[model samples]
Target: MSTLLATGFSAVAADSSSPQELIAKGEYLAIAADCGACHTSPKGGAAMSGGYGIQSPLGTIFASNITPSKVAGIGNYTEQDFARAVRQGINKQGQYLYPAMPYTSYSRITDSDIQALYAYFMHGVAAVDVKAPQTHLPFPFNIRSSMALWNTLFSNNKPFIAEESVSPQVNRGNYLVNALAHCDTCHTPRNALMGQDDSKALSGGSLGSWYAPNITPDKTSGIGSWSGEDLARYLKTGHLAGKAQAAGPMAEAVEHSLQHLSSADIEAMVAYLKQIPAVNTGGSQSRDSYGAASSTEQQMRGDQASAEPGWAVFSGSCANCHQANGEGTSYYPSLFHNSATGADNPTNLVSAILNGVHRNVNGQQVDMPVFGPDANFSMQLTDRQIADVSNYVLTTFGNPKVSVTAAQVQQIREGGPKPLLAQLTTPAVMIGIAAVVLLAAILLGVWVSNRRKKNVARK
Candidate 1:
């Protein structure tokens, strides 16, 4: 398939010569949107035949089947229905979708791209009869109607409007970053109500146990020190050799989305990202500042040597790949000065220890063995053991201030906290707030009526 990088936008030919061409175009758009990351089941399921369980504060919301199966998927949806659902967060049945689907960002996608995505899902993709497990969000979150208010508050249900002032490349980059990539959804901090805190866009946020670090061009906490090529390399390969490496949600993104995008598109994203305002998060050292390790083979092997609990675990299980000194080989990442290890928050390190890293770059798999019992890794680190190792890693090789507790490790091991506000906003609370407002209005109306009656009597 021929990909055109015309006028700074990475797009397929407008006049697709055949159905194959159109399907190809649609496939590219689907890659840009990264539908497969959330839509496809992680357990080797069919494409777009959603069965993946998305962990949120409310509960586990399963990704819905989007394939064009007559009975179980989006076969019934019209182009308008699909477009509306993709852009407005409303389904064909008029049900509101949670922000977990990234509709808030998808809302900014262009009509042409949405049409392409629709074509890909409805035609190019294979249909599966299997139905995804229904999402059962707890309490007020389950009340899908309540999302109407949320949409009104947060969702920008408008198509991309190119900035006349910026260069074509910047506008293209803006469109890709703000709309297709949905970078803000992960990187930007959320408010009390879980809306993206756009004021600090791309300045870092916590995705439960994983921390999405600041991508803004700030010299300290953000990517200010990084060149456009640095950003591009990180996106394309999920690693930047010595500077940074992707793990957690970022690794999944690279594996599923950015790696598939064209070089022009990645460059455009980097361009747009570099132009964003820099935000400082108080750290003085550069992102890759954790000191390198010296040889610890002898220390680790010594029977009489006193090692920390985590060090003992690392020596036994992790040292083979990561090395006794903590400086890993080309395949296994170095612990010192690594992004996963040196992060301000210890979530990603804990998550990496539990979930493990496995991303394919340029046909080579960069794999890490999971330490958690369930995820099919060789080693099963207990909660206490994981905590001990996590704390040791943070203290010795990464940020010493960031320490993990056994309870924290256990919570992350069991899929982190469900969205706190979602759980807190119960049905009773919403009803109570509504009732109070209604009662106040009624009392005001009654008082006004009595006042009007008195005035009439006086007349």
Candidate 2:
């Protein structure tokens, strides 16, 4: 697959001579897209056997097993069945997959790539016969048919077309970002319908507990401060020393997907990302250009530990790995000049505190100890205590503007606010409701008519 550097992927994928080449290409494509991040269960199931429960506003939407199993997976799926499922969000059984699968972004996958993917799924990977737990979204959301209308309105069905104006490399990068990598699934803000708001594309999107920061090259609010190398390093390794570190979903992405891409593909992605239009999400300072090292660890040493809740927690729990100055070692990323802490939203910062950094990549475990209860390593911090420590870190080593509330910490802990899309004026929900109502009325009319006939017959 390293031969990808030798020729254009679009061309190479199409001209691959043997089944092995096609399978290899598909494997590489799957890595770039991070398919396993969603399909593979974090709770230790067979690879791609899919018991992974994705937390959405409505309920936990479980990912279906995509193994090539005859009974439990997609072994029976033809190429067309696989294509429809991947691009159009329709299953082999003609069911609508929830948008959590990112088929909208995958909709741009070229036919050749889709074929490669299909082949790989069928041949390259070992099949597991485990069935995924069925998703039981409450009420109207459970009506998967409504998604057809949603798709009609929101999803772009056309495949990606390489713009003649852009360089071939940039075009390749665009394909990866929009189609395969599905960056917009997290980075782009959603509309009221929970669809990607293209107007604010790559500006920043909410992941309930964590916020995906703006990546549109804005000097203040986004990654405009990062050089190409810095961005590439951050993407590949999930850290940039003094700049930023990945946690939550982004951490998983680096561990599973981005780190596995070839050097050529990485460059292509950066090249495309560099030229995208800058969008401002209303931050006055660069996320990576905030705060300084504090000597709180020193200040709190001996019996002089300040009673301030945040400082006390930081001095006691955080000062060990992060150091007294907040500079941190190579393994432990510094708290200051960090993107998560410096962002306008404290969600990411709070999230990291609540759910500590955990990623295993390149044969090493990069773990920040968890503070939450049940798994409360050394620190069994409460929600209020976590909030205080969050505020303390923000004020001392991160942004001074933003602060976390105990309620907010609790909300993040419990998957944030549930924005009921059905509660809105969405036509899709209304139509489903109307149809149900109409059916009920028809049934009532039939019952009344039958009762009248019964009386007549009795007479």
Candidate 3:
């Protein structure tokens, strides 16, 4: 009986040791999960003491403080409460959290990971007194219960199950991209009800001001042109191939999360992104001409120009580079014919115009001047003018079925563009500028030398 009791006590000790090991493991997992990116305030505000504002189509939702603070954070939450929140999107009171918390993706996280996350937050992380602000939601959406129905339709509770047939690397890539990274949440286009169109996974979608471009392996519409090294470099440095750079939300993602990932993890993300099939939504085909002869002709034909305020704005400001026909230059793509203008979401186009676009050429650089107050090209166009131009482009060049509002344009202007703009410094541009200066100096030197020779000859 004494021996049996001693054995039972030893078993209890071993079981207790598991929690400490779990806590340590959970801390590392939490880093990989990047929980601090959204939950914590910027500039390293009390760690995990959430007070970040997450913008959504519905409204700006403030992240709740998740610190261990008894009064302000998740101090009151039990392990089950934490698990339900992570895996089931339920609060301690059985209320649903918004999908913005990304519990929909976290639902696929392993039970062990969930428990470890709980341990890290509950025991490992420091508590803070920071109070999170209430979300600014309009009307019926303020009610948390509405999320219950949204969850029923959109949320999944199943954890990730690796496939047996695929290579281990591909499986790992799939788990990170689909589950923890939640790439589909942003890249995948949504249906009318806001559920992800699984058929078009990672094809692309328009967030408020910026469009997350298609990331699938389509030869034309997606990243099929990108090599694995190019993808890895872009993920690391936010710029690749002089054609694209990570901006706005993507910039934030890079600064906070992706940059910290292991090289293997980054490669895995690239590999998984490459595997997603390309999908074409078949919205708009080309930039719109608006049936006007030319800018001069449009000016002469006042009736046609006056009918649409948007077209007038575009004619005035954008016609210089984009041309009167909306056919853009070699570097400057024609608005009517380009995929960017014809996307389902006009957010990217509006953001690009309002903020400006600069594409790299051969590791050299060009800059699209920003017309906003923040940049040098500060044009005094009113919010209405901006909206009118954006609407005109969307209707004419983009999908005719969807329409954008002046208010939406105003929001985008105020919200600002993403992928923090790099300073206009490119080697090619620098070299060209240097060459011009050198030529001018040489010409001046020759002229001075000739003048000195003439004076000597006259003397």
Candidate 4:
């Protein structure tokens, strides 16, 4: 069988002789799962105390505390409760958790791995007494019970079971990607129900202001050109010179999770990713295959004037890091042949420009200044300016086909395209609506019958 990576397993040796040993294994598993990325408050709070707010189409869903504190955290949670919450999206009190927890993918975790994770969280982590802010979505979404029906439709992936035809290594990689990493949560496009579209897994999805590009093996609009080494390295470090650089949530994933992964685990992920069906969501050519070094030395020299709106903004704000030719520095990255810059959506580019990039890889920090309105001091860019700069960058150093408008910039600034669940009429919603109607009709009929009886008695 054709494979993308040089195949081998580099094992992180595990010892399960004692409780401490299990806790150690669990700690490694937690890093692989990237629990910290969502649970850790970016604004400063106790670890796993969960004050972070994840913006979704439904609303800002704040992560809940998973610490060992009995007061507000999960200190009192039994192993069964933990398993239910992690795999079934149900809390100790039987309250349904939103899919934002990625329980769908987590459902694939093996029992042994779950035990290890449980041990680590229970005995390893420091308890934080504070609780995370509760997630209150809008309208029908706020109705957490609705998720029970949604779960019936979506969250059906069983625990990890290796396929007979595939190699154990590929299965191991599959376990990491689906069970622990939950790569599909970000990479796969969501259906009308806002659940991961199984048919189009890893064909790209939206992350509010930023868009997650395709990771399928397709030669066009995907990572088909990226070799096994390229992928493993990218996953480990979050940046591949002349290919792509991590920004936004991807950057955070790298900083918190992927970079910490063992090379063998990363290689396994690459191997599994290679075996998935290739999907071509868009483009005639690869995303990173677009563009070349741009020369705006004329603008720098101030010899001739061009009416391009983004030129001035680029020269002033971006040129310092990206350089006049968009070649970038060793510490930074090149604009041309980069994924975010070359993607057809232009969402990531505009978002990166607006929100900036911050990632720490191999102990080296990479920071890109945000250009959006709420940026530090007055360095913020207006919607119009952001649009202009985006257009300019796309035309010169990135995908020429993509462009953004001030209106679009404003929309992205507010939040990317809303999820389809609220707009579309799904079966679950119809049932809820029908139930309400039936209840209302029953109440009305009861009232009428009572009134008629009262009138007859009076007569």
Candidate 5:
């Protein structure tokens, strides 16, 4: 593997002191990659054993086993095979991996870093003999062969080329964010084909039920007001005082990935992020700008009106932990000035209510109970009931205009928005439209040519 790496990137050999150094570097790369966060079992299982069920449009797509186990993992993969998988989205068996693996972003990784990552996974990390359950996406998505077409349309696995105009730190930051961290995979919105719309890079995206908000430095819709330290602290702790708190996928990213990253690397990411073009996604207020507590009179006077089902539900169920004024305790997050409740969209808030949230930060466990129908230990809310409570929270504690219907709650509980692929027209219909457009253009060109000829004859 080392010899092969030397052939591709001689710098890898030059930088590496010994096997220990290669392994150490690989570990660092893996931390940046955040592999364990996805590959590890969702049930608090071992790292890299691969049991997480990633919710997608079609269905749940389980992450593959990347551990160095001979049977259940990539233990038998050669260095070239590993490189192809990481950078090219090709498996040892010549299968096209789904874009969920984020090979498009990994494609930008330098060969040297790839070599170190291969070394770490192959030799440094312990081999785990666990086969994650195979993904069984419905119908068209189940066909792995179709992924080849998807890859052709969208995938780009190219090594990072440094721009001479940028500073060394900025270049390094770019590499980390675009390559190692694969931030664009979540932050960048996807087109109809589920390919990233880079035109609006870091301008927020939807991950099924969860929404990954814009991280581009926009003053209202992004992290523009946040200082470098604010970014770093949020990454390290998954909480930033009154500003924001990580939930859903962000929480997992912080708990498993960012917390382990070096302070310098975190700062570098911040530096680069701060410089990206700011794009406002319509909303004009900050995430923490809404849901301020009312006057002391309002706080003291409780509304226990049974006629208002939402208020009644809130008082009956939520007030114990969140308090009557929605001023959460040390264990629970406050509804006032909370990002989830105050965001322009209430997807996260609704999802949290339905699915709940759990995170372990440096052994300090933070968990919120699920109120969905299938929630564990008997804390389930009917569609109407959930809608009512959600509306109550949004209006009283978050935004007055924000509201949810029982129908919407039902849809979110089932699955938020339709997958891009599912939402798009059939391939046959698209092809017909293209053909008609081509025919029209050809006819117009011929007409123009004939008109020019007639004018010449007249002259």
Candidate 6:
């Protein structure tokens, strides 16, 4: 019995390795998990010392400092404790963590990867004593127990299972894209309960001031037109085909995570994304109209339009850009057809119009002229006007169920929009510009020749 115990101890000792190798592996896994994107403060703070605020349907939750600070961070956590927090969404005290941590997806990550991540974060990562801000949840939602109910209905504990029929690479890609990356959490539309509508995976959704575009392989509504090369380029450089670039949450994903991943891993992600079944959530199709808003208009007109101050304000300020028809310009984007306005939650719409969208078109970062006081543009609209306009858009053209207040819009405006505009020209716009320039040059040359001939005759 003593010999057996000695043998077990020897095996455990053999498994333990040098700290440097463990830390290096941990760094790679951390990148794969995109931990820094949320845990690290955006304004150049120490790594893993969280201060970034994540907006959700429930409330605005600030990320906790994962740095090895005993009092302020996860320094006291052991390997098993870290694993539980990451995989099982539990804190060291055994309290359930918010889904905002994306542990529902991370639950499928290999144990080996989780150990490596734990090692790197606890040892290699420098400790910082930054205190995390409390999440500002309204009323009864402030109760952590409510999350348990939310989890019971939506949470799945099962790990990703590889399909026997699919290729090994494809399966690996599927696992990474669906489970580990949790891409669907943002891209897929949600139900009234704010749970992901699995039936409509990768169809597109709005988060804060940004819209996660359709990624499924649908020719008209999704990314069927984008080649594998386009996906790779977008992931690598955050630019694609001069039409779209990664921005908002996606930009963070690219810069902090996807860009650092192996080319093979990226390819696997692309492969998995391509195979995702196309689902049409009937979001905005064109820039003119948000799509169909007859049902929403009918519902809103019957219910509290007169009592809602936002309705009157929206009619006055938003009607010009969005139009009374709610069909906006391609350059402007029609609110009626825009998914951002029509989302199950109105947080993004409130943030976007108040802050305005800054897009990169043809290497030019075109700022969506903001009417808010904070922006250097027109400041005709007050906070109330901004709130009313947002409310009106969501009810009349967007989802009527989701109501936004003036105060919420004010808070989001203070946070600002995600900065990830790419500098590149669209092919169609570039050709048109070139053609006009060539014609102008030819006409100028002809005028010069004619003027010279006339001058000689006069002499």
For lDDT, the strongest prediction is 2
TM-score of 3: 0.65
Descending-lDDT candidate ranking: 2, 4, 1, 5, 3, 6
Candidate 6 regions with alpha-carbon error over 4 angstroms? 1-18, 283-373, 377-459
- Tens-place lDDT per residue, model 2, 347-392, is 9888888888988777688988778764455677899999998988
What residue pairs are clashing in model 5?
none
Please give the distance, in angstroms, between residue 199's alpha carbon in candidate 1 and its true position after superposition.
0.4
Q: How much lDDT does each candidate structure score?
A: 0.81, 0.86, 0.68, 0.84, 0.80, 0.67
RMSD of 2: 4.9
What lDDT score is found at residue 454 in candidate 2? 100
Once fitted onto the true fold, the runs of candidate 5 whose alpha carbons sit more than 4 angstroms away are: 1-14, 295-303, 376-378, 423-459
Return whichever of 1 and 5 wins on lDDT. 1
| Residue clash pairs of candidate 3 | 247-418, 247-419, 248-418, 248-419, 286-336, 287-336, 287-337, 310-388, 328-334
Q: Which pairs clash (backbone N, Cα, C closer than 3 Å) in model 1?
A: 56-419, 57-418, 57-419, 217-224
Candidate 1, residues 1-459, lDDT tens digits: the string is 244322323353464666656667778777788889999988688989998988876778899999999788999999999998988889999999888899888888877777767877888888999999999876657899999999999997989999998888888888888888888899998888898889999899878767889999988788887888889999999998666778878888999888878878888898899898998887767656765785554465675356667777877778889877788888888888787777677778888888888887778888887888765444788989999988777777777767889999888776666454754656677788789999999999999999999999999
Higher-lDDT candidate of 2 and 3: 2
- Please provide TM-scores, in order, for all candidate models, with all chains considered together: 0.88, 0.90, 0.65, 0.90, 0.86, 0.63
The sequence of per-residue lDDT tens digits that candidate 5 reaches over residues 249-269 is 888888877777766777778
TM-score of 5: 0.86
| Local error of candidate 4 at residue 64 (angstroms) | 1.1
Q: Where does the lowest 10-residue lDDT sum fall in candidate 4? A: 1-10
Off by over 4 Å in 3: 1-28, 282-346, 352-408, 414-459
The deviation in Å at residue 174 for candidate 6 is 1.9
Q: Runs in model 2 with CA error above 4 Å?
A: 1-12, 300-306, 420-459
Model 5, residue 374: distance off in Å is 3.5
